[model samples]
Target: MLIRYSKILLTAALGALILLVAINNVTDYATNYQFVSHVMSMDQVPTGSPLEWRAVTSVTLHRLFYAFIIAVEFSAAALVLAGAWRLLLRRKAEAARFNAAKDVAIAGLALAVGLYLFGFMAVGGEWFQMWRSLPDAEQAAFRFIGCAALVMLFLGQRDD
Candidate 1:
């Protein structure tokens, strides 16, 4: 039984880590969109050139996609943590409901966001064939959301 909890907790920890990474990217985007876009334009960066990860290059960061990504990531992290908290406390009934709801958000909204970004990366990203190939900040926000989802899933599975 203890081993089971440990396993679940371990899973949660990994998931949280991924989610945190995604969140960090979201922060970077929120904080640096304008700067990045300016840099991109200043550099006269060709669309086919690799994206400068550390360098603010894309003015497009101010787009709706960026905002949507941030919101979805936030939701994933928030709901995942909330559900995990309930489960950790051994509130099985509540945990189940909360976790279920969170799972829906993560799988639905999170999934959509991820897919959209992936496509954007492929399309405007020019198949990542650009010279620098950096994604401005590499989107740590998605990692954070993924991590949070993992943790919540673990909690939901816990026998406690």
Candidate 2:
């Protein structure tokens, strides 16, 4: 029971963190937008690199990409928070019931992991060569993915 509560709380916490990130991005749109633009432009990558051709130089595309990121963040947060709520409502139920309520949370965490691991790291870091930039976000994405993955593992355990 205590462990179930812990899992619910951790899921909520992660959801809150993601919500905050989305809010920050919306509230400070220009600042974060610049980061996205820079990464997409790949201007910071070594000038002569062969991968430079992969850069997305269009301003419209940068805005679209940033918008997609915000949308995913919001969706993940909503799902995780809703899952936590469902868990809280069923906290006193049987283990099977509680376990059944974890699906939404698991989906949310998976989205978060996918966002950071595939969206940011694989696409931005490797494809766009964001790692070569001064203000790279690959480390941040790694940390986020790690935390989300750990929580997903913990939450997946049976509540017996």
Candidate 3:
């Protein structure tokens, strides 16, 4: 088990390194991916600047970025289910099953919120209207998911 965890950690480190490298390459190659025509929105743009950064022409790239975000969110949520399955199969600590399940469920909830964020960005609905007009309350309510999951996990882990 220790070796498995070590490998997972190493893989995660390598993934992070790869991402860093990729982002650096993207930054270096920023000019090759643009073909601007007009300013997108002057209302929200800052003025008195040497370089104009309010325009966009990378529609293909934008869609890919959006799709990638959604894919990542879904993948993260699915990982929770995957973790639970892995735990059930390999974890011999019957006393910890509930806690483990709860942890996985919390992970799932986090992923669901990621999905929701993508939805909100894509839909562009009024952030505080047409759905009860309780943005703060909804945010607090969403936070409860992880809190409840954590409580369940801790309670299950307790000796009672």
The lDDT of each candidate is 0.45, 0.92, 0.39
Whose lDDT is greatest here? 2
| Model 1 C-alpha lDDT per residue in residues 39-129, reported as the tens digit of each score | 3333445554455343433445446545655565565545545444533555334444434443443343345345335533443344332
Error of 3 at 30 (Å): 26
Q: After superposition, how far is residue 85 of candidate 1 from its true place, in Å?
A: 2.3
Candidate whose TM-score is highest: 2
Q: Write the per-residue lDDT of candidate 2 for residues 9-109, one digit (tens) a residue.
A: 99999999999999999999999999999989999877788888999999999999999999999999999999999999999999999999999999999
Deviation of model 3 at 39, angstroms: 17
- Our model 1 lands, by Cα RMSD against the true structure, at 6.8
lDDT of 2: 0.92
lDDT of 3: 0.39
- Model 3, 1-160: lDDT tens per residue? 4433332333233234324433543564343222111111222233554333433336764445445544554454455445545544544445354344445534544554444443332221132121223245346434533443443343234321
Task: Tell me the lDDT of model 1 at 101.
Answer: 40
Superior by TM-score: candidate 2 or candidate 3: 2
- Error of model 2, residue 160, in angstroms: 1.9
Sort by lDDT, best first: what order?
A: 2, 1, 3
Cα error, residue 84 of model 1, in Å, equals 1.5
